[model samples]
Target: MRTCPHPFASLVLLITLSAAAQPPTSPLGPVSPTTGLVLRDDAVRALIQESSGDRIHDGVQRLALIARDTQSGYTEAAAWTKTAAEAAGLQDVRLEPMKDGPQWRATRGELWVAGAHRYRVTSYADLPMSLAAGSGAFEGADVELVDVGTGTQEAEYAGKDLKGKVALTRGPPVAALRNAVVKRGAVGVVSSYSTPPWNLSHRMDGDFPDQVGWGLVPRSLSTPGVPAPFLFMISDRQGRELLAQLRAGPVKVDVSIATQTDTGHLSIVSGVIPGTRAGEELVLTAHLDHYKPGADDNASGSATLLELVRTYTTLIRRGVLPPPVRTLRVLWLPEFEGTREWFSLHGEEPVRRVAQFNFDMLGASLTRAHSRFQVSYTPDWNGSFVNAVSESTLAFMNRFNSVVYPPRKDFRIGSVTGSQDPMDAHMERYGRGSDHQLFNDHGIPGVAFSTWPDDGYHTSGDRPENVDPTQLHRAAFAGLASITVAAWAEGAGALELARLVALHGVRRVAEDEFRARRDLTSVPVAELPETYRLTRAAVRIAYQREREALRSCLSLGAPAAPVQAMAKALESAEAQALGRLEVDGKARGASLREASPSAAERQARTFVPRRVKGQELASFDELARKAAPEQQPRVAAVQAAITAAETALRERGEGELRFYQLPDALASYADGKRSVADIRDAAYAEYGHVFPVDALVELFGLLEQGGVMTRIR
Candidate 1:
């Protein structure tokens, strides 16, 4: 038998080791060079000291009390947040409403096994997530609940009599409802489906077995003559139990949903910390809508924004920090839809939206959730000085919260009444699935601060208890510091930040060269020529990419002379790196040569796609729903291509580009100047995925047909 050590043994060992550990005794000099950030360290520190985890937690707990959607609940939450912002002394605090048309709201809902045993399956009163969004009303007592396993196919219901009954399925609510409710005449659906574990590491049924999923039924009910019915989400464990009970005999359950589908406007809650400059500002945003108890998925992010407002406002008012040179504005809105609506209405406002720092999920307990705080910077193709600044700020927080043996920094930070868990944070290339997508899609660079692989994401497990107050404090500190640094990027600090952009630009370009060279040198001789072609293309495109990134520094009010110089240096760097590649190819008996464009590539090169004056690519879901009847087939084909591209890229271990990011990446490069071929090459270089030229041609063709873009011969 194995013996257990005392629980205090590790603590005692750590103390003993600390006493005997050899070191320079005193703190060492900086292990790394100082980050060229124009941070107001004193002000940032004051804000950090003033930030309240408890207050943030209170905000989250309060917001999570309402099952917020794009309906009345969202309006209520917005009103509360608006009041809080005003009370915190933030100027220009108000709720701006944007109509999203009619939306669904569930008032009372419950599903229970109504036999002798009286087993309660779920109730919206107890857990709001149990009621899926867009679910219609269905009141019935002891309706026969038939187990139709994955009832998404006709074959699953061939022999089942679901007429006037309820379907218990392990498939998506929409798909199951279409088959069981629409085709087989079922009255409602009980779905216990979770996305496959491989795609989302933590959203597996095995991980959170009792988590009632949050999902949506189709809003339009676009199918002709199909009745809109109710949808109830039960846990995977409850679903399994129901399935097991079905093995013995049939089950009868009572289903009641008092829901309403009504017109409501999506609203945005806005507050600002005043600045010296009138027309320039940095935007911080978080989505405020999710199911009840949606703590980490975004109540945490929204609550943190409130805390930032309080801390920054109080600090500035107390003379702890000077007013910003550029205004700092924060927004709480419905995810995606609200952002798109806001920008559409205010796209040409005189106020320049310089940059964005979007907080999405910031309060996951790192240890419990097996999650790490991630700063997803701007994409490589869309790289900016903001990334370097964010990196520097994250580094500062890491050192500030660490338990270094001999301390690199002279100070450390931890909440006295909160967790002491080490801050696990890292930086990665751009990722989609947040409000920042809107900023990056429209030529503005943005960064999204979040936690990933959250097991409870989009489920009932995303409760307030799962959120850590300490994590909120750290995230708030890092985000506030980063945005402040960017806001104050002028004078000497701006020069340093500009230099940092140049340095990071060089490294980014060099990284592409490094990867290409490694692959070129190792490939067989017959494949060497083709590899060299792609290698050379990567190096050339990297220079252009980094050059574009360097230009973003000018948005910080940095001097144009230095930024232009840095851009010129990128060309020089590319030449040097390409020259080295030539030497390697020469030694390998492969001559450096550009591959002639194939017929398809040449054809693609002839057509230039331009945005339709001022239109961003509509989301695929919206396009599918709104497309004319004749365009339905085309929409389906385009979606298939997107799925195929993402699948192929994933199979090749490519993660930089995700499925949802394809349209945005394409839109980013389609500036009316770059041909389809040029855009494809640049996108390939940025993401390391070789999307076929034909795919680009077809996508652009579809976009043109949709009136979002136009093709010039």
Candidate 2:
């Protein structure tokens, strides 16, 4: 009789064996598998159609129409694409506009320009906090002017509220003072100088969604550490002379600006690249439109995907790319608004999508990028195919153009934190500021791509001239490797079952009894239905946390040390999640009453053991005969994870570092050292959400103290 390898057990063995073979590495979580499970053409094709973006050929024609006189947005872009659609044998072509920013505000005060109305809010007092205050530091005292340089210190602001008069403070050298000014609320501050001021410098947090780092500060970019704000570098000595003039007399001006919300026509563009296979699906996508003129901003990717339509189709026609395993659906969304609408329209469709490959800003120099071949993956994909199912889809980027363009080199990708133990992750999400968000929110595997270290992001200079072809090639090739292959090493049932299990883990598709039972031929245990599948994954993850906490409590052995504090923190967290504090005297409570002892006692206790301590474990069929009908499979799964964790805790070194900090892309984006554009490119590189670089670093610090992981350095 055939028997299946234990799913949870196999996962344990994989982790155990891999760690034994590796050496010390970075703290950036474990690197993951770069390839995806290969599927048959029919299955893959269905998934593709359910995914991918629109296929437009003859870029020159599409561009020609876009460059036409009447083009304001995607509406005209789509209307002109009729001929291209017909040539591609597709009928519908849409040009949809995505509305973003009005909902997004610049957290920092903006520097707007109009012919004669040019004013610069040089200090933090110019932001919203000060916006409501109306007057700039209008204190009622005799104004004594002090050129304290940039007031970036508690000390600079020490002992005085320099109000009612110009408090000549220096621009910040190290710490940013935008927030400090809100508290200081000085009369008026004299900013000695500034570089070519960024109109969007003070951006609303929401506008920059991905966690791209601003970048590592070039040593020569400015003076070493911004000492006192007075010493910080600014534009010119002329501005300094002007500041000296301000101290000569009283300067007062009325400050007034009106802000209102307006209604405008909003749209989202969507197109498709069909596949021969009808059932399974794969999605290829990229945002064709942006808030600013983004040729390299996205023109590089725009041109790239337009070219991919030709490349993939040509491969199919020549039988080189092979028939897709699923139907491919290509989408050129207008970003945020388009995603919201698409989901609203088709949220209920139960299409089996193999994966979603999202390509965003994919043009930049490969050699200069922060995370070479780095791709940010969402934490869910292939419902049952994956164990942790933490990845939306497998996201991989070529190390350099060389990784994809052959002379074919091995794409050496690094975790945002690569200096750790066994490399099991790409740590891309640390840099997840991009377009893959909709899919992740919708519960699909989303992998995004962009060249890390986005030097030309959002500024006027991020033009077509700065675009790089190799970056596009790396992203496209990496995406194809993970989503488009075939051959069922685990068999069709495993493929299907794995997908089912993964989905079941996430609460997407429900598990059907018939299918689970049909595959029972290889089962060493009884078949499970949806109810059992869910209970297991949640409880397993839950107990893993609980067990670690309990062990921390035990290790401290005594009650109030750091170890004990950690144990208590975990215990408190576990109790909140489960609805009851499992403290000594309070095991049973109203919130988490179901899993209590009384609850367990109420349900009949059935013990149909799968494995014995001495002999080979009994099969599910045999256990069923001896077992009572009351035992729940979920209860069994929880007990299983707990038992496993306890075993590991005994042998211990440090726990999995992945649990602590974010991936390398994120780390690069985080402010301690790496650059911002690098982090932004990570999500674009991997096709995922973009997080703020500075905030994530703080989070990494918190995780280190929690004992889930230790910083590698």
Please, what is the whole-model Cα lDDT of each candidate in the order they appear?
0.76, 0.37
CA shift of 597, model 1, Å: 2.9
Local error of candidate 1 at 407, Å? 3.3
lDDT of 2 by residue, 56-150 (tens): 11232244223211124444544444344445433245655444333211222222211233344332222222221122112122334445555
TM-score against truth, every candidate: 0.90, 0.41
Measured on C-alpha atoms, candidate 1 has an lDDT of 0.76
Q: Where is the poorest 10-residue window by lDDT in model 2?
A: 607-616
State candidate 2's TM-score.
Answer: 0.41
Per-residue CA lDDT of model 1 for 319-417, tens digit only, reads 556677789988998898889888877788888878899999998888787788889878656767788777777777776676533153323445545
Q: How does residue 703 of candidate 1 score in lDDT?
A: 77
Model 1 ranges off by over 4 Å: 1-37, 40-44, 196-199, 222-227, 404-411, 522-530, 591-596, 620-641, 652-657
Which candidate leads the pack in TM-score? 1
